[model samples]
Target: MTNKTFCVVCKRDDASVIDMQPHLVRCLQCGAYEIMAIEYLQMTNQEQDPLLSAWIRNRTEEQASPPLLTSSTWISLRASLRIPNLREKQAALMKAFARRSMFPGTVGRYNPVADFPLAWAANEGELRFLKQDLIARQLLDNEYTMGGSFLITAKGWDYLDSIPAGGVFSDQVFVAMSFSDTMRTAWTSAIIPAVRQAGYTPYRVDAAPHIDRIDHKIMVEIKASRFLIADVTEQRAGVYFEAGYALGQELPVIWAVREDDLKNVHFDTRQYAHIVWKNERELEKGIYETIVAVIGRGKSH
Candidate 1:
């Protein structure tokens, strides 16, 4: 009889007498999608090598389910913020949050940045918890302190900059969204027609071309275009990279994602204003709305 072991996710080690093959486990504790024997060995031996230890830690954290903010902790922080001195301390902590270096023995007090530890220690655990939360949210740097004031990290600042005024988007719009293979084909076919109908020349950049010599031409064409229409399905890395390039150039770019894949999008991309659709009707409606909201305001691409 073949030896059998339980899967980490299922936690069932018993091998059926009829079928004794080893099975992978899925660990609910960590929300790991699949836990193979090889992965288990890697995890167990991560500490043997310093490089592997760091790599494993990063991978594990990345794959682990997101942590939820504790209600009690949130309430405590909110109440503490109401205190006059604590309010100032919280402000100081926020200002210092993004700095990469810290002075020991300082935090909320004036000139506290001179002694980082003092400021951190003075806040007790509440400030520490709040700081950690900010780091997790990408609102602050994990290891940063400046002369007792907290600063937003570059990433945090970029995120803040991405938000349009009054939450009313004006630079980007969704011109198309499709999910099924049929829908995708139809949307692709309609793109040129739709843009033309909108009184704009239909300049296109085929984002999903096979790796070939034509890739250069595609890029050149995109660069020459006055506006961008990005299709973000299957999470194509190239599509996302190109979309970002257009955005950086201050071009008006429309973001369209498949409705079924909305939950699978990365946090950075999902946070941005976007349109999602699953069918042709939804796509048309979404595009019209985006046109009226972002393109109609005389915002130049």
Candidate 2:
């Protein structure tokens, strides 16, 4: 059974709380997420509500359930969650249609008010801008109206087709991690296998074949790959740099750190969630779960 109540995350009244161990909430605005009673009581993320709300909204992927947020995940996600840029949001909206449409030219009408979060917009007006831009770019129908059917154009189909298929070209994932002698076992046993298990090829720049200037090559590899995993165990400046570059490219980043070393993570980035692990086994589980949650299972999964 589900009980109606205001959402703890978004404070929206249309939320239904499932009667269970860890409270499971389904909110019209924030989608569905599971939170522990203890974690809820200890929550300190009130200061960053907007970002958290938007993050929850975006997690309502095609059919995936919302991720479980313990004390650990909430902090990492809160620290790293950012409002996507306009172009990124536009792409997301189109990709959504591409994935959800049954066939080409399938007519769809999404509510600008109720579905604004689908495009990561703050309000209906921002979502209107997205539809307007798509209409102008010939990605959507040319009609101008407030509430009506929205259709993806033939050009939109062609555009989505031009994107990489079969996850063929972008299956590689760049790993930004320390090469510390202490981390070798974790690298080989934990991170690499976890990525491969998730169906992505992991490429650590250090292990890749490269002839260009090291710095330039790192950036090139990052740009050509899918997402990146950043482990800041040793506080390496290079790891931070690569992670920042990937963020600039608007790629998903799964952050991880050794539990013992987590306290040393930079103050600016400590807010973002990092899979803090005391052992390689914990690290592997956290990394795999996070990859599935943030970017969905890769081609291999």
Candidate 3:
């Protein structure tokens, strides 16, 4: 059997033999260069290779555009440009550009643990603090509290970078958030899930509570949230009021609406691009872009 070579970066199989090195092959499609072995398992695991990450960065360029769907040659040209330290710098630049492009969007590479490094808790006290925070936020939920032993919800996980341990967690609580209800049924369902997916927990204030309360908890919560979202369905009064309140608080609010509804939307509102969605897929994609914008803003600041 012939040795199979694959580009570790793009994860493609289109490779070419190199004249200089008999054992090494190049991904002609995506510019991923590598060496392989005849036995399937013998190829060095790219992730495990200490130098591979750095090498990938050195081998790839910053301006290397995203692969075009139509061209295999374009696919092969995407060099793995992410060197560890260099990758951070690249991320920062990308973040800065993203910040300028939009507000309150997702940032970084979208790590599942929301940026948790491997083997995060080496000591007991640090682990204990994480548990306390999770409980305080009601993320772990009392039903499953394991005496400072449990997992965190997405909201809880976002705070990991804020943890004082100088790890990925930061100390910032809910700096900003977005909310909207005057949306198409499909879009309404998509927005919240997308917000959560972006790693920001958006609280829906659909029903107003009793006007009198010790903390004006609902409004206060909105105030504390760093941003807001309002879906204006052909000028719903409630949506306008809430959006106005967030704007008054100087919170970064994003408006979303259907295409037909835009005709009746106010000129002032029109000036600011209301995130529009024709369908659920578009709504999710919009939300992801918004998340990137939010993350980008955070990084730049």
Candidate 4:
């Protein structure tokens, strides 16, 4: 075996450096402070890496079974990983593992942009930071060599399990619609009331005072909402972008379009089931049913 220092968390050897005289090293990639082999061995005969050993023991108990891909627990776990910080990238990496492990015959490497579009790094430095944060948190296993993939540990799964699926903003529903007078009126008179009946608070951008950074406000709302309702009646580019962003975050999105404008819905989004309505009443009814089905009954107020 090659003698090298690696993060006890994200086993990558590249970013770790000797921190003390003996048996102590810190991984800059994932921010893991670990005891070296000699000290680790002296402390416990169970294994050189206690964290890895526990994970192995757990896996062996279950016959090395793969993660449950279809369980709600798994869905929530994956969705919760999309944090706003470097943890988002780390979660995406773990999600990639869960996804790959689900399909037996599938073979390919993880592509940050393709698999983790929401948390894709802008540059190598950002990617490095993300990996480092994951390692430091002990959520990811370290790689022993360059270009090696890291694995999620038992602690990682435990951490994910502790995160609530819907979180605090689970009852907030964001509306992405045209900013026309007719649309605004429909939202206030019809959509808002229907959303209220369905137990979710409907939020529209226009409700806020206009600011120079409107897009930033929209993004913040999108992140804060449990789901999004995108009205593509006018084929607004912004609505499409908002919906795409929600999808990237693994948030549920309800697509809506006027019956007359249905033909103009973007081809890329046309495949998804959309609520086609002729009037405000029809839109309200359709949206209400969709919301209940997607998110279940909202918290009783």
Best by lDDT: 2
Task: Give Cα-based local distance difference scores for all models.
Answer: 0.44, 0.75, 0.43, 0.59
What does candidate 3's lDDT look like per residue over 52-100, in tens digits? 3223322222212122121232233223212234223222222222223
lDDT of 1 at 226: 51
Best candidate, TM-score: 2
Candidate 1 ranges beyond 4 A from true positions: 1-183, 188-190, 206-212, 297-301
TM-score of 1: 0.35
TM-score between candidate 3 and the true structure = 0.37
Q: Could you arrange the candidates by lDDT from highest to lowest?
A: 2, 4, 1, 3
Predicted candidate 1 versus true structure: per-residue lDDT over 1-301, tens digit per residue: 4344432222334422122122222221222122334444434322222222122222232332222213333234334322223333333344333233354223323333122222222323555655566668766655653333455666655654463321121122222223447545546555544554454444333333333355454444444445566767677676677677667756677777768877877677776766787765566566556655676522222
Q: What is the TM-score of each candidate against the true structure?
A: 0.35, 0.54, 0.37, 0.48
At residue 39, candidate 2 shows an lDDT of: 73
Q: Which of 3 and 4 is ahead in TM-score?
A: 4
Query: What order do candidates take by TM-score, descending?
Result: 2, 4, 3, 1
In angstroms, what RMSD does candidate 4 have relative to the true structure? 16.5
- RMSD in Å for model 1: 19.5
Candidate 2 residue-wise lDDT, 257-282, digit = tens = 99889889998788889999999999
Summed backbone clashes in each candidate are 31, 7, 30, 13
Q: Cα RMSD for candidate 2?
A: 15.2
- The model with the greater TM-score, 1 or 3, is 3
